[model samples]
Target: MMTLALQRLQNTFGYDSFRPPQDQVIEALLAGRDALVLMPTGGGKSLCYQLPALVRDGVGVVVSPLIALMEDQVRALSLLGIRAAFLNSTLDTESAWQVEGALRKGELDLLYIAPERLLQPRTLELLHHCRIALFAIDEAHCVSQWGHDFRPEYLKLSALHEQFPAVPRIALTATADARTRQEIIHRLGLEQAEVFVRGFDRPNIRYRITQKQNARSQLKRFLETEHPNDAGIVYCLSRRKVEETAQWLSDQGWTALPYHAGLSAEVRQAHQHRFLTEEGVVVVATIAFGMGIDKPNVRFVAHLDLPKSVEAYYQETGRAGRDGEPADAWMVYGLQDVIFLRQMLEGSDAGPEQKRIERQRLEAMLGLCEITTCRRQSLLAYFGESEHPPCGNCDTCLDPVETWDGTEAARKALSAVYRTGQRFGVSYVIDVLLGKTTEKVTANGHDRLSTFGIGTDLDLKAWRSLFRQLVARGLLEVDTEGYGALRLSAACRPLLKGEVCLELRQDKRQSGGRRRQVSTDQRLTLPQRELWEALRGLRRELAEQQDVPPYVIFHDATLLEMVQRQPGSLGQLAQVSGVGKSKLERYGDAFLEVLQAHRGDAADL
Candidate 1:
């Protein structure tokens, strides 16, 4: 059975083997054992249950949350010559009935359905009659109340195990903390299930968090300088922001589209389809768009606003660099973002205990943002894992930041805040420091403060950094509601009176020369460039042909690596970092042919 599954994986999935934990999970499922699979976003979590579904004696039932995901998965499975169908709200009565007919006739090998649909009395009756080999739950973290994208309907899915106690169940998610993991096991009644936890280290994605200042321009610079003509997602916090950013990016000559909950269903689907099918298109969206999006060549994931928690941040950033090539997880945040997020939590009707737990989660996220250590290490540690010596790929690891004694500056800033009655925003405080005599400053009579203009030695940007660091360090608190006035925290008292010294890491700008620019002259030349384009064309064609993401064939970095190495044979091609045995066997000859043609031209020269 295992050998047949492996053969099917090679011949059908176009890969010779399973990713790290996939085989183990598949074996457990095939043995009629329940399992919990925790893998990173780019990891092959789908194959664990997918292969088992194909190999099992009866039809496999997959419960997914999103409609788009259901469609994409069913389409992908069907393209592989597997009989698969989905029953979702998008299907009309007749279409859904047709799927039911298929299910009854045992014509479908895999069936995808939404959680709500699966829990319906009629659907449950139908499922009880059918011979279900295994029940698979994707995005299983949504079952946890502590998770950001919690769905109350998922709580009903436990009935599946209740009804068919003998059928094996497998749950999978890309981002789940320890709390969520425990919750999934308890809620799904899978306490005895075999659990597989993969490493959370996304070494290929360069993690970075910049203080939000002129975010649009920063994003523009990042796209123009680092990832010109590359595909990416620019995540915003609001529908308006998504539209505005998409329009701005389009005006700047990028193939950009807006996607959010507010758009019509047709428009949203169109935009998402365009983003997936078209290359070099940027999708400006809220958190609604990322789950189950299998686009593999996304070069970057940029956050224009801070996410609600580290889990959401990790999952969203995980969307990039899925093909194990070099990608970036760039985020711009500020003091206001913290306040905005807290305000959202406060505005929720959830219980006080739930609110308290959420606050702690947000605080933990803030700690991640503020930590001076390696960003990747800090992130992994949050998920109850650790990386030694830190990943040398993130911004913090690539450029070691410097710290200076900000004791005096903190004292001055605190004194100014105290003198101004601790009721002003950052801009007002800055005006007081610069002695600008702005209307608001004068109207509030902050100009008359004794500590006014004491920070003239530092520029406006420096003062802003000091303020942001103070907030990040918990020396100051921004009121969640209202205009976000800065208030002194308990930690500020000691620093204000000089009883304790405070140190702040010099901002990324002050550290200088860390951001690398791709030089035009060092770029690929002549036939190499031509070959690179041809390889990319082939990748797109193969991606469409296979109905998988393009990067799954080969990443741009791998292509460039191939162009540079010009590997002459399959063995030489397998030496490339991303090229495993399966990929080498499948694509090695085509690439070698391209390289050989180029080599002939080089010899002629």
Candidate 2:
């Protein structure tokens, strides 16, 4: 049975085999067993459910939260000649009726519906009448309040399992922490379900976080230097910011567009279409974007502001390098970001305990932003996993930061905060240190303090770095409600009593020859760098021919491997990790010919 399933995956889906954890989940589902699958974004989570739907005797019902997701999946499956359709808010009356008719006729192998729509009485009655071979819940993390994308509608999905107790069910998500995992099981009433947790490392993505200073200029530098003509997503925290950033990038001559909930439906659809169809388009967006986008050529994901938590950050960053090629997950954060995030959390209507948990989450994200250690290691650790020896890809690992014994410096900084009654922001504190005696400083009577001007030896940037590091290390907290006042955490106790030593990364000059060297080394290499364009072109040709997603034919990883290997024959091509006998049999000859001809011409030169 597994062999036949593999053959179908090859002949119909055009894949040679399943990714790890995919077949396991499928087998469980085939046995009429429930399962909770936790895989990463690019880990082939969809195949676990989609393949089983094809083999099952009746229609497989897929419950998804995002309408865009349902539509994309249905279209992709339909292109592969699978009998698939989605019923969502986007469907007109006639289209909905047609889909209903198809379901009644057992024409759809897989049917996707929004959870809210599925809970309707009429919809439930229709589902009851139609034979259901399996039930799948995508983005299952939405059922957990601890997750970033929680929805009230997902709670009702449990009743579906209750009503159809005999049908096999599987819940899948790309991002979920330990707490969220438990919540999903309880909320879905899957007590006896098998659980599969894939490893949480996105090894291909180079994680980077720069301190937020002259952010627009820094972003421009990244665009010009590292990813000149590649497709990428620039995430902003708000709709207004998305529009501003999009316009700003466009004015600077990049093919950029804005996408947010604020845009009209037609405009949003147009923007999405352009992003998917076009190359080198930088989509500036809020969290509303990229949930179900099937584009696989995005080479980078840049966050202009800090995300609310590590889970949100992981999922957003997961958007990059999905094609399994080398991609970047770059972000810029600062002291003000921490303050802003805390303020947002405080303003939420959540209960005090929820607020407390959220604060911890925010602090964890801040730690990743501020740490001198490898960003990848710290991030993985937060998800209850660890990366040994750290990844050599991130900025910290590639270029080790210089550390200074700042125990005395930290003591003085803490004294300054204490002397000021922990009521001042970083700038005012810096002014007092530099002995500027500005009007606000004098008004606060801070100049009379014994610690005033004590940090004059260090420059303003160094002072800022010190305070930022303090806040990141949990020795201090920002009072967001009090206009971003600096408050000491309990960890500050030891430092105040000289019980612990402080070591801090020296503040590197934000601009100079060193910056130039770093930027140049980080620049994308030719061909390997051009892989995105080359793959997109190949994808366009393949998609046009096969009527399937570019991703379905061969992902970014496979294309990059092809370019790197320039395989001259079917045997050499099969050596690539993702290319198996089925894929080679289907499309290998043509791709290899192209690669050989290109390589041959280059060699002649």
Candidate 3:
């Protein structure tokens, strides 16, 4: 059975071997055992259950959260010549009925359905009568109420286990902490399932967090340096911001689109479709845009505002570089973000216990943003893994941020806050410290205080950085009632006196030197570049003819391999990593023809 599974993996999925823990998870499910698979995004989590379903005796039923995700997976599978279908709201009644008929006739290998539809009595009755391979739940973290993507409907998924007691079940998620993991197990009734925890580290992604200073220009600078013509995601905290950023990027000559819940469903769907189907498109969106995004080539994920928690941040940024390529996770945050998030948290309807947990998560996220050590190490530590060395990719490791002793500076800043009655925001306090004789300052007569004009040495940017870091370090708190007034926290008393010294990273707002541009066609010669474009042209033509996404026809990685290897025959083409037996038999000759021309031209040259 295991050997057959491996053969199917190569013949159908077009891979020589399985990724780590995939083999184990597949073996368990093939042996009629359940599994709770915790793998990061782009970790090939789908194949853990997908390969087993093919090897098993019946159709695989996948419970997906998003209609777009289900459609994309089904399209990709169908391109591999698999008999896959999805029953979702996107389909008309007649089309859905046809899919149901296929399922009843055992003509489909896999069927993707939303949880709500699958939980219906009618769908359950139909499934009960069919030969059942297994139930695979994608994004299983949604089952946890504590998780950021919680769906109440997922709470009812326990019925799958109860009703299909004889069938194996596999639950998978990209991000889940210990608490959410336990919650998933309890809610999904997967206690007997073997748990597979893959490492949470996405080393290919470079993490960079900057203090917010003109976030729009900063994003542009980063984009120009890092991903000039590549696809990426820029996350914003609000719908208005999403629209504004998207328009701004568009004006800057990017193919940018806005996505948020505030947009009509039709617009959201259309925008998402474009993002998937087109190249060099950037989607500026809120958190609503990226739960099940399967786009593998996102080069960077930039955050204009802080996410609600570290898990949210991790998951959002994980959307980038799903292809295991070098990518970036960049963010810009300030004290205002802190105040905004705190206000949102306090205004929520969650109970005391839930609020407490959320507060801890927020604090952990803040710590990650402000950490002087390796960002990767701190991020992994939050998910309970610790021993990584300093990654030389993040801002701190790359530039080696310099820290200055800011004990007296902090005391002076705090004193200004106090002397100004602690009812002013950061700008007002900074103004007082810088001895700015504004109308409000003169009216308040705050320049008469001892701390006034005391912070002449530090620049405005430095003061902003100090205040932001203080909030991050929990030495300062935001007064919600006072409209984001900066107040000294109890923790600041140590620094207020001479009892403690504070070290802060010196504010350096410069962009790094231009990075080396990595192009997909870099390895190709001038002649090969022509062949690469020709090959891509053929792919786009075939995809358009078949009405599928170009990637569904062949991923950029696969096309690059074909170009590099210049395989001349079906046998040689089969050796390409992504060229499965079915695809080889169907499209091999056409691709081989292109390769042969390129090979001949190269020889002539």
Indicate which candidate wins on lDDT. Answer: 3
Q: Model 3, poorest ten-residue lDDT window? A: 511-520
Instruction: Give the Å shift of residue 209 in candidate 1.
Output: 1.7
Give each model a TM-score: 0.88, 0.89, 0.96
- Measured by TM-score, the strongest candidate is 3
Per-residue alpha-carbon lDDT of model 3 for 490-539, expressed as tens digits? 99988887898999878776665345435566767888789889898988
Task: Give model 1's TM-score versus the native structure.
Answer: 0.88
In model 2, the Cα lDDT at residue 164 comes to 93
Comparison by TM-score, 1 against 2, better one = 2
Clashing pairs in 2: 323-557
Arrange candidates by TM-score, highest first: which order?
A: 3, 2, 1
True lDDT of residue 76, candidate 1: 57
lDDT of 2 by residue, 309-332 (tens): 999999999988766667888888
Summing lDDT over every window of 10 consecutive residues in candidate 1, give the lowest-scoring window: 512-521
Best of the two (1, 2) by lDDT: 1
Q: What is the lDDT of residue 572 in candidate 2?
A: 80
Task: Report lDDT per candidate.
Answer: 0.83, 0.81, 0.88
- lDDT ranking from best candidate downward: 3, 1, 2
